[model samples]
Target: MDQTDREILGYSRYVVLAAAFSAMFIISPFEYAWSSMSGHIGAIYGWSPEQVALMFTTFIIFQSVGMLPGGMLRDKYGPRWTTAIAGLFSGVGILSIALGPSYPLVLVLWSVGSFFTGFIYNNAVTTGNKWFADKRGVMTGLIAGAFSWGSLPFIFPIRAIPASAPPETFFTVVYIMAAIIGGVSIVAALLMKDPPSGWKPTGWVPKTKAIARPSEHNYTVSEALKTGQMWVLIVSFVLVSSAGLAGMSNMVAYSNSFHFTATAATAAAGGIALANGFGKLTLGTLSQRLGVENTMILSYIVSGLFLFLTIYAGMNRSEWLFVCAAILAIFFWASLFSLFPIAIGHYFGEAAAGGNYGVLYAIAKGSGGLYGGILSTMLITQHGFPFAITIAGVMAIVAGLILIPLKYSPPIWKDEEAAAQLNARAAVGRR
Candidate 1:
């Protein structure tokens, strides 16, 4: 706001963004690499696909659970300390997972790692909004898009495997991966914090006070839940986002089901990562111009159609078609990430965006954390990818429709009220 504050913001934002991007780089790879270890893990641990899938299910459960508290911590204490504590916890968990002596230990370690990883995204989004108040949508999208950083490390591992090798070896590799990935992520986490406006980039501007005005009237997390629109966001995203997560969590396996080798399937999954990152950046920025609600609707429509296309591609067993369909699928899928945060900023203002978005994210992603793994495996086992992907696709269409009601609705807080509210919440608690 002031010249000194602007300069500080201009310089410090890069460190903040890097911290977020790095976290994504470490944790995201696991999504793409999961299937590669499936067969090997199954052999060594002597588990079934249902069991292995449940491993992911557990990760989701913990991650969803962690988001609310993580966001609240970030909201309460600010970005730096929250991420630092989380990183410490995440590093320990991942290390434990990598060194697991038994299957039960692996589950415990992985769950802990997943919960800590949840801390990074919450801080990253919160920090990004703090960094670029003027360009909230675009900036948020860019940061959200960087979630593909998760996919970056996975390409190599997914490609290196020999089909005949046991799944248990894959587990060992993941364990090693857990140590390496977790280590780097912990280091990255050290550099993160919320920057003052105009601190890092010269031209960077905070989102207009109008677009992201904090409520002068602060709402407790409980108070926020009492609003009418909160349920809309929760129910809508839970239905639609579950489909996206289902696809993301299962992309590699979904491709394998179509007859591709694990390596090839992994590569295709990376493409989804690429699309996800790009979609977040593109759609997030686009929301700035088209409006968050409109952009979200479009993302839903596009993502749904592409998901259905995967079914068609599967039936034909056309690698190119499948690849194309999957690539397109990422575009819409990634947009969901950006839009959710941006919309929260729009509806709630930045005052409680961290906590507000955290709750919605908890519901949407948490449910996916459970529902997606089950749905993906069940659908494929019973009706197959066509049936599975089609169902998800329909949910996306409905998810897009969820935004229709927001068009006529105004933000829960106006500008003058927002400033007062945030100042109050930022103040102190009564004994």
Candidate 2:
């Protein structure tokens, strides 16, 4: 390509990335912000804690299940239309909740919204994989990090809602959320496009024996499913993600149980949110240097340690220690957001990133959600928070051990350069 073409590619790639970041940020309230709304909504509706938690489980189940078809659509038709559709679903879903007549209706509407948001999430992550193949870790981290911190803007406002506020205030906040999520998502979706096959950034060069280049060959979803490594990765994903989800889904409630004041508890939750964002940003970049798997191992182990410390903080009634430990645990969880996508692209090839990774991620998240949301709630109610935290910590440590086997596995696909190098060497031997 000439200078003009390079300029166009450069401009389009960066702009699309920016748009993906913005979309992830706007759409974040659909998931992460819900925790802030849960207690108030429960109080207003005269629902029990378990009932409120069931709504979260409903949202998570649909959100994860929807990613399969949503990812297929993005791979086939591209992100533009799919993301626009997601924006519509998100707007309508949030609005319906604001005007919902009953609790069941609210749950259904939220689930529908969660389902569509998967489109936005998958499209954004896949875009980073497609555009920044050379810088996959950093770009994926930025997208995930945006998602990690996106709830910050809404956290305070949502938390401020009194147990018995006028319904108008709640409706207004949701309405504003709908508009921002819908408007920004649609705009960003329109701006995105996939780079042409075999495209690379200007002035970039591939290794003579490059391995796992998507340009040479990509794994189809079916083909990727047949790999043992994929299964291992998925199971590991489920275990670690479940731990993170459990902590995040119950962080506020856990703080309250420790006798922290409402203000302090909410602040602790915010601290968790910040830790999530910083973990993605820092660890994502760190993965580039340390390797994604190595970084994941470190993240999981450290998180497990801090999670155990959280139990100690609760026993000692040290709010600061509790908050710090909670933040570190959450930080490790957030790192997975970056690591998994990057690993998927490397293992499965970027050509089928949207579909293949989508399938794996959906299963991982669906199972993890169940473990964290309803299961954690059950454990907390019956065995108390300490037992739940112990389970989560053990799962995190187990996840790290599961990934240790991957160190010996080679890339599933060989790039053109690597194939050619092998062929040339064989010819020399024959001569």
What is the overall TM-score of model 2 with all chains considered together? 0.92
TM-score of 1: 0.85
Candidate 2 structure quality by residue, lDDT tens digits, 1-431 = 52332365556578888988987888776667767877767766677888878877776777788878888888888889999889889777777667555877888788898898888888888876788877777889889888868888888888887866787888788889889888998899878877764456777664422223433467889988887878988998898988988888888888889998787678777887788878887888787777777888899988888899999998999988888888888888789888888888877777788888789879998899898888899899999999999999999999888898776673455465588789999999999
Tens digits of per-residue lDDT for model 1 on 56-122?
A: 7776777767778888887767676667667666656655534544778777877887787777778
- Candidate 2: lDDT over CA atoms? 0.81
Candidate 1: give its CA RMSD in angstroms.
Answer: 6.5
Top TM-score hit: 2
Write down the worst ten-residue block by lDDT for model 1. 193-202
